[model samples]
Structures are given as C-alpha cells and as structure tokens.
Target: MTAVIENTAGQGTNTGRSFEEIAEIIGQVEDQSRVGVCLDTCHSFAAGYDLRTPESYRQVTADFDRIIGFGRLCGMHLNDAKGELSCHLDRHAPIGDGHLGLEAFRNVLTDPRIDNIPLILETPDDTRWAAEIALLKQMAL
Candidate 1:
C-alpha cells in the first residue's frame, strides 16, 4: 500500500502529514515490497514543502531520498497549488497557473527519479490536460 500524504489539514490534523512520519511508518518496514508513497505536489506545498525554486526543489527531493528512499516513491501527483505555501488548503490548481510557478513543475519533470513512477495530473482543468501534457513533455525533454 502506498501511504499518500493526507496534507489537507497539515499540522492541524496529524494523519500522514509529513514524509518523516510516512518514512517512520512505511519506510522502516522490513518487508518493503508492499509499501510505498504517492507525493501530491499541492498537498506537499500546503504542508510546508517548497518546490518552487530549483534549489528548494532539489532540497525537498533530496530530503525525500534521504528520509524515505527514492525507491519507495511510487507515484507523484502533478498539480499546482491555489493557496499560499503551508496554507493547509486542499484546493487544486492547474499546472503553472497557481501559487506554484512553472519552474516547480519543470524541476519535477526533469528529475531522473520521476522516470519510473507514474506522474498523475491532479489539476482541475481537464480541458487543458492535453496542453498540460504537452507542456510537461516539453519540460521533461
């Protein structure tokens, strides 16, 4: 089972709030075959993770690698956030159309750790899914 972070309430509610807790739970399991994680970009940002800049992105991902192991990264939800960082809101925004700028997603698209996992678009604008997909592809290359 992949322990997706429940970041809607952030620190307000403590169920799967941070990667550290997730790491403490799933990442420490002796049998690692069944457990993993799905990182939601919006939830992550809302939960106080900064991925807007290249350095911050690298730092956040490096933290993930160190704490949770990149091998346990099962999925990623690629969505921009509507609220400010650590706002603890679950609002979903289109890629590059919210608080998280295009650079944030560009960093994600270019990361080699993303090659194996599925990148899910949790954006609200399904009409622009094709355009977003194209943009992400371009960014990836």
Candidate 2:
C-alpha cells in the first residue's frame, strides 16, 4: 500500500508535512516493506522542498532519501505549483506552466531512482491532460 502525503499548510491537521513525518508513519507500519510513499510535487514544493533546479533538486531528494528511503517511493503526483516557493498553497497548475517549469518535470521524469514507479498527474484543467501527458512522455524519452 502506498500513502500519499497531504499538504498541511491549508489544512488544519499536520499529517505528512515533511519527509520525517511521513517516514515516521511508515516506520510504524507492521509491514513497512509493503507500505510506500507517493510524493506530490506540488504539495512538496508548496511545503518548501524545491525541485526546480538541479542543485535544489539534488539537495531536496537527498533529504528525502535520508529521511524516507528511496526504495519506499512507490509513486508520484506530477504537478507544477501555482504558488511560489514555500507558499504553502495546494494549487496545482498544468505541467510546465506554473512556477515549476518544464525543466523540473524533466528532471524528475528522467531520474533513474524513480523510473519504476507510476507518475500520476494531478494538474488542474482536465482539457489539457492529454497534452500534458504527451509532453511528459516526450520529456521522459
């Protein structure tokens, strides 16, 4: 089972706000091997974990690896944030059109560490999903 971390800024509860928190929750599970995390790019960025540039991406991902083993990353929600860095907003823009440019998506899509998991899109505007998917596929190759 995979647990998708939710944003805590807008919400009253403080569940899954950081990698440490998520890791702690997963660690408590009886079968941690079967439980994994689903990272949402928008929510993460909104929570202050930047994934835009290579250096920032590396640092943030390293932090994630240190806190919540990369092997436990089972899935991802690929979405650009409409809010600025550390804005604490849950708004999701279409891939490449928001604060997180196409480069961010490119970085994640091409990363070998997360190559095996599914990348689900949570961007707004259902009409542009086809185009977004196509664009991401193109980037993946």
Candidate 3:
C-alpha cells in the first residue's frame, strides 16, 4: 500500500482513525506495483520516528514491520535530519552535521537487512554527498 499521510502538517492526525479504516482504503487501490516504502529519513524524523539510538532504531524497524511490513521497504532516501527527534520539523542538512548524526547513519548502513536496498542521500551539497558517500563506504559491513 502506498500510504501517504494526507495532511502534510498534521502528519500524525491519521492515528485518530482506526487501522481498519486505513486498511480499507489501501485495499481499494488497484495498482499493486510491488509496493515499497520510501524511507525518507527527513520525513521519518520529522514525523516523530527516531532513528538515532540503537534502541530507537530497533523500535523503528519493528514499527515498520508492524505498520508497513518489511516486504515493502525496497529503497531509502538517506538525508540528515536538521531538527531534534519528534520535532516535526522537515529540514535537511549535510549528511553528518544534522540532528541524525553520522554514527547513526553508520549504524543504519551496517544493518544487513538494508544492505541490498538502494540508499540515495538527498543531502544539501555535492561536496557533502562525496563526504557522506565516502563515510558510508568506510562504514559499510
């Protein structure tokens, strides 16, 4: 299911509705198209999903499995979060300097399950991209 939160600002407001209601709508959609989750780090962080600490990262993994299912997660846009956890602020910075630090991203890159997935950094600058990619390469398992 291609689940996009309808209200851009009020992202969590969908929680008010029951999961069945949400599932019903998703069921009606025709195009299966091998549904995949786009893990936009900025959006996940902005929408109150913490990917910083190991425990938080584990929680996020579990939540993704429970809510969206791991089957759909084929790609990620790995940008740095500019604001603090649960801040709901959607700002993107260079890979390592922002709120979601390089260590956290290193941990993510090391995860074996996500190793095959495409991780494209939508960070600020080309220079930052080179640095981040180098950092990622160094950290890769």
Candidate 4:
C-alpha cells in the first residue's frame, strides 16, 4: 500500500504535512518494502517543498531521499498549486498553469528516478487531460 500525504491547511495539528512526518509514518509500518509514497506535487508545494526551480527541486528530492528513501517513492500526482510556497492550501490547478509553472512539470516528467512509476494527473479540467498528457510526454523527451 502507498501513503499519499494530504495538505495540513497550515494548521499545526495535522500529520503528513512535512516530509519528516511522512517518513515517520512510513517508518512505523511493519513491512516497509511493500509500502511506498504517492507524492502529490500541489500538496508538497503547499506544505513548503518548492519545485519551481532546479535548485529547490534537488534540495527537496534530496531531503526526501534522505528522510523517506527513494525506493519508497511509488507514485506521483502531477498537479499545480494555486497558493504560494508554504501556503498550505490544497487547491490543485491545471498542469503548467498555476504557481508551479510549466518548467517544474517539465523537470519532473523528465526525471529518470520516477521513470517507471505512475504519474497521475489530478488537474481540474478533465477535458484538458489529452493535451496535458501530450505536453508531459513531450517534456519527458
């Protein structure tokens, strides 16, 4: 099973608001090898892990690797955020159309670390899925 962390709404009481907390939850699982994480881009950004720049992306992924282990990265939810960094809002915008921008999606779609995993698009408009998928496929090239 995979654990998909939810947004904390900037409140202090929620779990899985940070990478450390997610790691903690994963750590407590009995069979770690069978479990993994489904990282939602919007939620991660809302929780304050910036993916808007290459440097920030590297830092954030490195922190995840260190804390949660890349082997546990099973899936990804590709969505843009409507809020600013650390805003803690769960709002999901269409791909390449929110605060995350197209570049961030480009970088992520091309990353080999997640090559075989599922990349689910949770963008707002169902009509845009084909175009968005095409765009992401192009970005992977």
Candidate 5:
C-alpha cells in the first residue's frame, strides 16, 4: 500500500526528468521488461507536452518517438492537470475541466497502440467513476 501510494504521489509530481530522459535512464539496464511511458494528462500538461491541438499533439508524439522510442510507451494514466504545461502544479481536475479538454482525450484514445493499454484514472473522487468512465468511453474510437 505504501509503495502504491508513493508511486501515485510520485507520479503526480514531476520528477524533473523529461519522459524521454527517463526512458534513456531505464534503457541503461541490462534486462528491461517491456518498459512503457505512462502519460498522466496532468503531468504531461504540467510538463509541457501539450496535446490540445492536432498539430501540437502530432509534434509532441513525434518528439516522444525520437526521444524514447514510441514502442516503449506501454500505458497511460489519464488525468487532467489543474495547471498549464510546465507549471508543475500538482492539482488534478476532472477530465474536461482542466486545460486538456475532451479533444485531447479523443486524440489519445484513437491511437491504436495506446487504445488497448490500461487507461486508469487516479482522480480524487472514485464515486464519480461512472461519469468519468462515461466521458472516457465517449472519447474512445
């Protein structure tokens, strides 16, 4: 439980290393077992990986491919950040309430590679699961 909590809290806060930078560090290991980049909308937005526009989304993804090898990105922790990209604020808003908006979620869900991975929500209210899940479902391809 402590590990889970720590990991959750740790993820919410930017560890300073960029996604690609983290992948490089992880790649230094001898035996990596299908390492994947998990992008929390909050962290990505807070870290400056803007996905609000189509061109911006493509550019960000292209950069990700260059820096970390897109194949290594195996999962996503979908959450909306309360701050603008690069702000580093740790607040998490509901799916569409934050800067990401609904289109960003739609764009992510359409990606064939990412579609099948776990899109877990670590939002503060689990009771709102039904509505959040529905919103995510609507974003699905």
Candidate 6:
C-alpha cells in the first residue's frame, strides 16, 4: 500500500509536510517496497511545497528525489488547490482555475520521471474532468 502525505489539518502538527519526514516514516519498516508515496499536488502546495513554475517544480522534485527517491513514488494525485500556498486547506479546484495556474500543471504532466505511474485527478469539478484530462495530455507533449 502507498502512503500519501496529507495536509497539516489532516495529519496534525507534524504531518508529513516534507519528503524528509515521509522518508523517516518509511525507514521504520523492514521491507523497503512495502510502502510507497502518492504525491498530491494540492496537498503539497498547501503544505508549502511550491509547484507554480518550472524552476520551483524542479527544486521541489529534486528535493523529493534526494530524500525519498523516485523509486518510492507510486503515483500522483493531480489536483489544483482552491486555497493559496501554505494555507493548509484541503480544498480542491478545477485545474488551472484556482491558486495553481496552468504553468504548474505543464511542469508536472511533462515530467518524464513520473511518466509510467498512474496520475489521478482530484479536482472538484467532475464535469470538467474530460477537458482537464485533455489539457493535461496536451501538456505532456
């Protein structure tokens, strides 16, 4: 099973806000593959891990790779946050329609490191899912 780091409100004061924290949690186990991480874009931003620009995306992902390793990245929850950065809110918004812009998504969908993993949408508007998926597909190219 994969362990997803949640926002502070969900996981309390010392939530797995950083990859280092999650790494610590993952270290206590015997079998390394027993746990993996499913990164949530919204939760991550709310937790203060910026993904708004290409540079920010690179830095944040580099931190993740350095701390947790990409081998443990099981999947991703592709979401746009209704709340602003570091707000600690769990609100989900339609892609590119909230605090997170399209550029943030462009950075993510095009990243080759996560190419083979399942990328699930957690955007609030179910009606826009198809269009959102299409937009993401275009970004990947």
Cα RMSD (angstroms) for every candidate in the order listed: 2.2, 1.9, 4.2, 1.9, 4.1, 2.1
> Can you write out model 4's per-residue Cα lDDT over 1-141, one digit (the tens) per residue?
554544343545678878788878777888777677788899888898888888889898899899888887778899998988888888899987899998888778777898998889989999999999998899899
lDDT per residue (tens digit) for residues 53-141 in model 3: 88888887786677656666667788887788767666788887888887678768878889788888888888667778888888785
Residue 92, candidate 1: Cα error in Å is 0.6
Model 5: per-residue lDDT, tens digit, 1-141? 010101122345435336655665667755565445666667777677788887888888888788776766656777777777677666788888887888888888887767567678867777887899998887784
For model 1, residues 3-62, the per-residue Cα lDDT tens digits are 444333274666665777787777567776778788889989988899999999999989
Question: In model 6, what lDDT does residue 36 have?
Answer: 84
lDDT of 2 by residue, 2-73 (tens): 555543433346578788888778778887767777888988888888888888899989998899888877
Candidate 4 residues lying further than 4 Å off, grouped into runs, are 1-12
Overall local distance difference test of candidate 1? 0.82
Off by over 4 Å in 2: 1-11
Query: Can you give the lDDT of residue 86 in candidate 3?
Result: 66
lDDT tens digits by residue: candidate 6, 1-141: 555543232335656777777888788877777788888888888888899988999999999889988888888888888888988787788898888889999998888887898899888878999999999999999
Estimated TM-score per prediction? 0.88, 0.90, 0.78, 0.91, 0.82, 0.90
Q: Which candidate wins on TM-score?
A: 4
**Each prediction's whole-model lDDT (CA):** 0.82, 0.82, 0.67, 0.82, 0.69, 0.82
Q: How many residue pairs clash in each candidate?
A: 0, 0, 0, 0, 2, 0
* Residue 118 lDDT, candidate 1, scale 0-100: 92
Clashing pairs in 1: none
Q: What lDDT does candidate 2 reach at residue 7? A: 33
TM-score between model 3 and native: 0.78
Query: TM-score: which is higher, 5 or 6?
Result: 6
Q: Could you tell me the TM-score of candidate 6?
A: 0.90
